[model samples]
Target: MGRQYAVIGTGAIGGFYGACLQKAGLDVHFLLRRDYDYVKEHGLAISSTFGDFTLPQVNAYNQVENMPPCDVVLIALKTTQNHLLPHLLPPLLKPGTVVITLQNGLGVEPEIATIVGETAQVLGGLCFVCSNKIGLGQIHHLDYGQIQLGAYGNNHQPQGITPTMRQIAADFEQANIPIQLAENLLLARWKKLVWNIPYNGLSVVLDATTDAMMKDSYGYQLSEQLMREVIAGAAGYGLEIKESFIQKMLDYTMKMKPYRTSMKIDYDCHRPLEVEAMFGNPMRAAQAVGVAVPQITMLYQQLKFLDARNIAIGN
Candidate 1:
């Protein structure tokens, strides 16, 4: 029997992965919000610079009650939904199902494991894609679609990923998305986190893009300062990423086409920013390791203030 895949929170990352799996001929179901009604009626529309195609008659569920048990659950919800886990997630797991988290942050595995179970298989994946929910059933791909996933567990001291990580990666690869299985996933998580933590927040707070921020002398300096601190925080936890490699990452993101990040999108929509997962988690980790993160801490603080003020003023 082919693996039963349930794509939870069918946003850009989940939709993209589930679409790939569906293309690969996996038994996939999308548990989405009401916006996917059109997807169920007309299937999913993926519009990319490469091309556009509609996957006709794809399965979509508006409510969890209508969903069936799945072998693997890919979770792509924003980190803002993390607190609601106890109420929203328990019923979705089968005996041996693994829930993969594609949220970019530090120290998420532990929190997810605590909610699901210590022995529950929880794979962590990093999505390097720029996409937007263009319509009810359409996802507009802007640029960059790459994935880095690995068993959050080790050969002996395992926490996430059963024996199925390789199979999952293989299935996703067959779906035509570039997917890589990493032996050391923490490095990837930290790597991705380094990019997201500062840029995403800064973009929304300042209404800037990767290039705009890099071009503006003050913003560019702030990015470097915050990123260097993040790199130090990683090393404090024994992730020895070189300064040069970190600069390369910043340069890549800076050179990307003018793109408003997820944070900027949220700010524009008046939705709550995922301040906790994207910024709070990493800054907390740095504090735990006694790594000074003054710049990031300040950014996080200001962002939190923005949210708090907005909520208070009903904006």
Candidate 2:
């Protein structure tokens, strides 16, 4: 009778965190896709730098319609699969269901808001984790596992940190995952782009890991320029991204392990990249405010071509 939790999209992000929540003794149900049968029989395995564990038997299902309504729903699906939400969310939501999206990029909470309407309290969560599903029902957590939480209001306005946000944060804290609340979801999205725009783009375009980008002089400089463009874009939207944050992110990356970005991995696997949500929208937002982002625009155009080709090949 603890919080009834449901995890939609049980891939790397969802699988890792959902396993953590379930291990913490919550009534967590996993709505899996391709790995549903494997996980249901063999359980989910997590290999983490902090620790390693496995759930011997998880409440697993393959369809939303079969899952019971839950008090909390963690949406960890890629934005590319968001079109399924209007059909996927209704059966899993009750009167006070709290929906938290752990996906990247901007404008996600607003999109979910439109689907769930007033029945659920939707929130945005930025997960700072380097983890991937290395095999069927297995997640390898390489490094970093902090979460930044923010409340989403009507029309996607920033509602600051509410008591419900605190309650969710407390739940995560009990599970040993660090969580921080952001005052504004939009500003938080912009801040995360300070690191994501550079590494996620360059990693795919240049075919390099994060350390490789940081070690090479040219790649390092281009990364800095991309960061500056993001800062300028944020400023154009009236969100001041301080100059020091660039160096702070650089230093942080320099200290972490050499990592392949999500987009880079998607490209390697021939899955669709999140170019529109991550790069295209930000570029358009900047241009609307009369700010020029030549570097970001270039990156968006290149990624657009690459993504389209991937889709074509898939077809």
Candidate 3:
């Protein structure tokens, strides 16, 4: 008997990864919202840089109560929908279930820890993939599909690599998805923000993609400046993010395919942007330690205003 997996939100992250796991012969059950009926009947289609494939039959469910308890549960929902976790998670928990949150921004694991309490192991998965749900039951993978897994610690300290992390890594590796285990989850979260903050936010505000931003002089310099501020903010928590990492991120974006960020997509769709998770929380964290992130603060304010107006106008 192999490990049974449950994907809580089968959007881009969950749908792509869960489909990969299932294609590799792993038992992956997907819990969907809007796409449940379509996927349940027609299955999932994935077009990726690695290759294109389809799952003709998926263990799809619309409600968690109808799904079986699994060894691993992947939560891929937007942080904004986290309020529903209390109702959606309990039914899928048995003993010793490993709940990995494939969400962006800070304070995710802590919130999950409170929900599951001591009943399950909490891990944070920082996904570095550029994917989007192009249509119902369809996911388009643009570039860079790798995940870094770290165990959540008390007060967001370093937990080091653990057996559970290795166990889950093996599962993903078997599915041909790249995995890296982090010694410090907090540091990894901040490191992800170094890329996410500038790219995701600026994509919406500037109404451009990565290529547009990287190619223009103003966009490029502003991105570098924001990256530096994020690096400085991380230092307030005693986390060392090397100056060279900024160039690495910039270089990565330069080579990536022209792509709209998840935040930008949300904004364009009139959906709520993850302003708080990606920007608000990071800015407040920096301010807590007296680290001033004026640029990040300004970006955060811009995003909040834009996000609210976009939703209110329904456009």
Candidate 4:
């Protein structure tokens, strides 16, 4: 029998990738909240740079309990919602199931491991994609969509590529989404932070998209400095991220479409920003290692204030 996949969060990241897998003929069951009714009746619409397609019929469930146990489960919710995973994940687990967290920030896989326990394998999926849920059951993919998969190891050590990782990668590859296998999940998470820390935070604070940040002299320079601090933080943990990678990310952003980052979008909509996951956890980790990240610290504090105030007023 083929792998039965469960997508835990049917938002932008989960919906886009799950639809791709289903489009490739995989059995993908989606667990949704608000869009459950619309998607069940109208299916999913994906507008992407790769191409555009629609899933006229999908296996959609409003709750995880209604979904079947599967070989793989993809958790694509923002880190802010992860607290609910303890309640949302159990119903979708089977023996030997592999849970892949397609989330940003450090220390995510560990929390997932605690929830699923010893019966499942946990992996970290680093998504370098620019995607957003534009409307109910609609996701617009503007730019890159490659994922880096790595095995979670004890004490944050490298696990090397495992058989399970290869199997998951094969499924994503068959769906026409690019995949990179990382031997060190910790290193990959840190590398992703290099891009995320600067753009996601600055976009909200500066009230600008990536293009504007890259165009203006001050914005561009500030981004570079934050990137360096993130790199230094990684080094404090014995992970080496080269300085040249900073320019590579900057160049990539320069070429990307004028886009609002996920954090910025959340701020605009009065939805909770992932202040702790995307910013707090990383900044605290760096501090724990005796690395001072003044810029990241300030950014985290500012986002915290804004996120709290925005949500309070919205409520």
Better of 1 and 2 by TM-score: 2
The candidate with the higher lDDT, 3 or 4, is 3
After superposition of all CA atoms, the RMSD between model 1 and the true structure is 2.5
lDDT of 4 by residue, 158-237 (tens): 99999999999899999999999999999999999999999999999999999999999999999999999999999999
Per-residue lDDT of 1-315 in model 1, one digit per residue for the tens? 688888878877788778767877888889877666678888888887536677887888877767777778788888887776665567677788787888777666667777778535878888888888877778887887877876765321333444577777877777777777766677677777678877888987788888889888898887888778888888877877888976897788777887788887877777788888778878888899799888889889999988777656655
Ranking by lDDT: 3, 4, 2, 1
Go through the candidates in order and give each one's C-alpha lDDT: 0.77, 0.91, 0.94, 0.93
What is the lDDT, from 0 to 100, of the residue 310 in candidate 4? 92
The C-alpha TM-scores of every prediction are 0.92, 0.97, 0.97, 0.97
Candidate 2 on 1-315: residue-level lDDT in tens?
Answer: 578899999999999999999899888999998999999999999999879999989999998999999989999988889889999999999999999999898878888989899899999999999899999999999988999999998745779889999999988988899999998888999999999999999988899999999999999899999999999999987888899999998888887778889999998888999888899888998898999999999999998988889778977
* Stretches of model 1 off by over 4 angstroms after superposition: 154-163, 311-315
What number of clashing residue pairs does each candidate have, in the order they appear?
0, 0, 0, 0
Tell how far residue 109 is off in model 4, in angstroms: 0.6
Candidate 1 vs candidate 2: the lDDT winner is: 2
Q: In model 3, state the lDDT of residue 120.
A: 93
lDDT of 3 by residue, 129-183 (tens): 9899999999998888999999997788799999999999999999999999999
Residue 193 miss distance in model 3 (angstroms):
0.6
Looking at model 1, residue 165 earns an lDDT score of 79
